[model samples]
Target: MDKFKKVQDVIASVEADVTKFYEGGNAAAGTRVRKAMQDLKVLAQEIRAEITDKKNSAK
Candidate 1:
């Protein structure tokens, strides 16, 4: 749940930048959006690993 909230927070933080990049044609915002995407990837991987570990432990 904590990691899920973190993922949501990351997306929320970048929502404006995503709009600026696509709708307003801002290069800097695009850069920020890219970084946020990378962060999201890492967070997603971490959550995957956590779930795997917990499931395996429960079995």
Candidate 2:
């Protein structure tokens, strides 16, 4: 759950950069967006693993 929250926070944190990159054409913001996306991918993988672990344990 904490990792899930971190996922949400990452998404929220990236929103400004996403907007800046798309609407304002900021290259730095686009870089940040890319980094944030990488972070999101890692976090998602972790969450998926955690869920699988929990499910297996419950059964």
Candidate 3:
């Protein structure tokens, strides 16, 4: 559950960065957005694995 919140926070940050980059063409914001996207990918995978493990254990 904490990991889920962290992932949500990162996604919000990425959204902000993307909006900032589009509004002002900031290279730094673009870089941050890219990094956040990569982080999101990893976090999503981790959550997926955790859910699968829980589901299998329930059986």
C-alpha lDDT of all candidate models, in order: 0.98, 0.97, 0.92
Native-to-model Cα distance after best TM-score fit, residue 29 in candidate 3, in Å: 0.5
**Better lDDT candidate (1, 3):** 1
Top candidate, metric TM-score: 1
Q: Write the per-residue lDDT of candidate 3 for residues 1-59, one digit (tens) a residue.
A: 97899999998768878988999899999999999989989999999999999999999
Which sequence of candidate numbers ranks them by lDDT, best first?
Answer: 1, 2, 3
Model 2 gets an lDDT of: 0.97
TM-score of each: 0.97, 0.94, 0.87
Once superposed on the true structure, which residue ranges of model 2 sit more than 4 Å away at CA? none
Task: Itemize residue pairs with steric clashes in candidate 2.
Answer: none
Candidate 2, residues 1-59: lDDT per residue as tens digits?
89999999999999999999999999999999999999999999999999999999999
Candidate 2 lDDT score at position 27:
100
Instruction: For candidate 1, write residues 1-59 as lDDT tens digits.
Output: 89999999999999999999999999999999999999999999999999999999999
Q: What TM-score would candidate 2 get against the native?
A: 0.94
